[model samples]
Target: MAQLALDDYPDRYHLSNELHARPFPELTAPCRAAHLAIKQPRDAADRDRGRDFAHLVALLDRHGAPRPAPGANHYSGPLGRGFLKWEMHTEFVTYTIFADGVSQRPFSGEVFSLFPADWLAEAPGLVVTSCLVRVEVAGPDLEDRLGREVLSWFVPESLAVSQVVDAEAVVAADFRIDENGHCRVAVFARPGIGARRLGRIVQRMLEIETYKSMALLTLPTSRGVAQAVARLDGELSGVVAAMAEGGGQENKTLDQLLRMSAEIAQLSTASAFRFGAAGAYEAIVTQRIEVLREERIGGRQLLGEFMTRRFDPAMRTCRSARERLEELSSRAERAANLLRTRVDVENQAQNTEVLRQMSARAAMQLRLQETVEGLSVVAIGYYAVSLGTYLLGPVVEPVGIDKAHLSGLLVLPTLLGVWLMVRRVRARLDHGATH
Candidate 1:
């Protein structure tokens, strides 16, 4: 028979001897058995040769002498370095049993079963490590019997099961069963927004991801988110009311109430993330929505009060400035209208009268100036004639003339010339004024 190799077996059939040794009460007694001892090879070349063919002959010698079987069914094959081969009737069990003096860890006692006859038909000349077991009986009860024997190896003592629920229905659950069949069950807890019991319930629900996510699914109109924020706002309002009712006194009780209100506000804001999956953006949106709702409500409530206080100083300044400006403008306008009316009606008549009086004064002043100019011309002419006669005295004396009598004759002709010049100047001035 051809020797079998270790790698030729499938993963399920690698059960060690410790797993097969598990006592099963279901198996019948007095079954035929064959054993083959395995040894690790010292030399590298012979290691590939598998188990010694002589070992199989020896096991046959100990059990029952070798019979002249004509087919390959009577021979045992080889497994790898740490394994041994054994055949019992039509059944084959492989064991790893090298005494190489090295310490080894025990297998975990997990076993898997397979049909080798079917596998061998698929792959000829294949040496597989799987055991080929043939039972004498077959029925529907076989699977149950095998299952019972398999599960008896290792079983746990306890189990736990949990379920998560939302407003709609159950969302998720995890089951853990034990050998004793006892289960510890847990379910998600949800809290109402304004209920007195809500705080503790919310704290518990915050520990669970599914419950937190469910709590945050409010409509867009801020009704649900608003209610949540209002709960905190109401607590703050109560504190304010207490202080107001106490006549603005700083009461320690009211201060504590305010502090608690602030803490609840912070918690309510932080808890928005509990309504959705961890790290989900919806959780953040819900938190922002809650904040905005609070701002809107408080803003509308305080709108009038804020405006009233804010405009008081500016309003007073504006009113005073406006009144003063209006009085000044009214006085200025009246003065301007009075001046305009006077100028429009009587200004030309006053100007004409003043012009007529100035003309009469100017005419008298002109006549007086003419008379004075006439006298000045006569005096200048007389002086000039007298000076001429005096200059002629020297020349006329050489001709035996009288100088005084010639000056007197010259003075009359000078006076007549002066009078004519003065009259001409007066006529020019009068003609200019008429034009």
Candidate 2:
């Protein structure tokens, strides 16, 4: 199994895709040209040029842009949502435009005027807002003309001396412009814009994205759980129907039917339990989704407030659904346990009745055996007495004794012996049975 370390997760980047359609080619060009101009030192003797160069380097470092290599004239960093580092030099600015992991192209264009030191002195705190503006002009070469026109906003005086650059060039200029032009200019940054503030802005943007993705995951899970619950409910109905349609009330068949019914009941109970679990899960997911939605919306609002400075409406909704779901889960558990207990009690009662019936039948069989034994003794005693009587008749005839009176005497003794033997056997059997 491949394991992903926590540190290996990629940082999410959030940039609106629609912003790409705007004329970014007209925006980054002049910034690159200004960056180059500061490095080349047009006046090596001038202390101001050196100072401007140092300031430009500081700005680039603050923005996390790469420094030019030793004896190298230019450098570039990943730009526009792929690391997002835009370069501003004396001559021109170059920044890469990216969409879906692939770079559309590198946009490079020339700068018209460098921001003077006085401008920084006037506005101590400034924020950079890069806006991609779109325009249309009538001509076969309309796009090229529009690019030039947009670039002119940075350097209105240099249009006559400028060279026609590539069609897909990026122009970099400050948001500030002289009021004497048709194009609107905005200042990109003021003197006091610091790294810490930029980091906070980036963090807020990331938070917004995180909450949005969490919402997406949660809502779907809730829907899936709800669907599962519905399916289980249908299954439970079928189990109930099966149990109802089977045989009734004949003990042997009823026992089998009841067992089957119990099994179906167990299944139904299981389904109900699952349904409740799924419902609870769904409720949890819904609550999470709602919370995430609120977070996403709030984070976005905060980001907007940070960027534009405004208040957003407060979002507050109670989670009654979640509470209801928990209650439902508890109820389902109780219901299932109750059903199980009832089934167990019924099965135990049935078993007890079966044992009772067996015991009664065995007792009756023992009584019948005792009765048969007593009758056997009576029959045996009568036959023995008759044999004695016949034998005595012959013997007494030789002695001149009455045979009939001798037979009567033998019958009394035989009957008494049979009665005593039967009584003893019955008593023994009764004692054994009691033990």
Candidate 3:
């Protein structure tokens, strides 16, 4: 029988297909784009997943936009005269709205007007980052255009402008919000630049912004928990100090330490995801900047350099907070162990005292039992002698013997016999007990 190569691994098809998912949108030059990332409250992970799907459907239905298949993670298609792309990620969803041409006034709020105001208000999540991108054909005046018009609108110190993709395009952004509370990116591409290349450039920019925003989400978390972490550390230090002092309410101290440990553990569990997600997102932000392989434009700082100076510090703060949490947790654990050891030693001492008392009582009971046993023998001998005297009287009277003398002689023998018998019974009892 012909055997097929071992049946493909159950997820082989799905796993391989994932790489092709969310392919970059094909775009033409002279396009104005609006990108938005929306995130629910921190508790969104537990919210109904259907809500996201429903929201996507509502937007698609509005413009007669083609519906994505059920359980689709991404979609790109026509929205009126332009195109729209939607992608769902682990923590949030992204929407990119593309138009055919650049707005006359750069970074105008008009691009966002494409999404009906009512529809936006009904979004399940609030906007985390919204950016207006101005894409135009490249010309010899690229540097002049930026120095004359764009540079004035952005902060001189923070602006990052770079030429990328073999210098076919120059991209610049200040990473700062404008008067309308939206960031702006200007992309000037040479005429012959392929649509796919332009699309890749745009995609990278959006990703940089999205992941950067997500990474920053952990910053507030870090700050909020900073004081609590410090307090716990101080308390833990006190506990350890008291432990070192070698006395004074070790149990109480242990209780306090354990309580603090519990709190720290709970905090760690609560923030674990945010910290981990931040680390991942930060890495992505760094990678996205690297892949751009940027070169300086007109002595402007490269994107990589800008992020190093400006964005890197924020990420470092997040790292520091996470490290502090870990250190505090470890300290709490060590303190708890020391306190438990103290409690165990104290308990052992108490048990030893209890045993000593038990031994003393047992000895006393043994002495009292011996005295009772001696009295029992004497009583038994006395009863035996009285009976013997009565029986011997008749025999003595017949022979004219002295009954009193016989009784006296019998008393010693009776006492000896009763004592011997009592000892034998006690010996047997002791032997049985030993067995």
The lDDT values for all models are 0.36, 0.38, 0.85
- List, residue by residue over 83-167, the lDDT tens digit for candidate 3: 8898888888888988888777777767787688898898889888998888899887877888887777678888889999888
Taking the tens digit of each residue's C-alpha lDDT, what string does model 2 give over 240-320? 454345433224433444454454454445344334343443344334323222212111222232212211111100122
Model 1 gets an lDDT of: 0.36
Ranking of candidates on TM-score, top first = 3, 2, 1
Which residue segments of model 1 deviate by more than 4 Å? 1-343, 398-401, 421-435
Question: Per-residue lDDT of 1-435 in model 1, one digit per residue for the tens?
Answer: 877665555545534643553221122211111112122312211343323333344434433544323322223333222222232221122222211111221111111111123432432122212111111122345335333532242231221111112221011111122243211111122222222222222212222222122222222213433444455445545545654465533435435554554554454444333222222423443343232221122112221222234323333333333333334334334433543454444667778989999999999998998788977987889887988798888888877778887787778887887778777887898899899
Query: All candidates' TM-scores?
Result: 0.20, 0.38, 0.93
Candidate number that wins on lDDT, 1 or 2: 2
Candidate 1 vs candidate 3, TM-score winner? 3
Please give the RMSD to the true structure for each candidate, in Å. Answer: 36.1, 20.8, 2.4
**Candidate 3 vs. true structure, TM-score:** 0.93
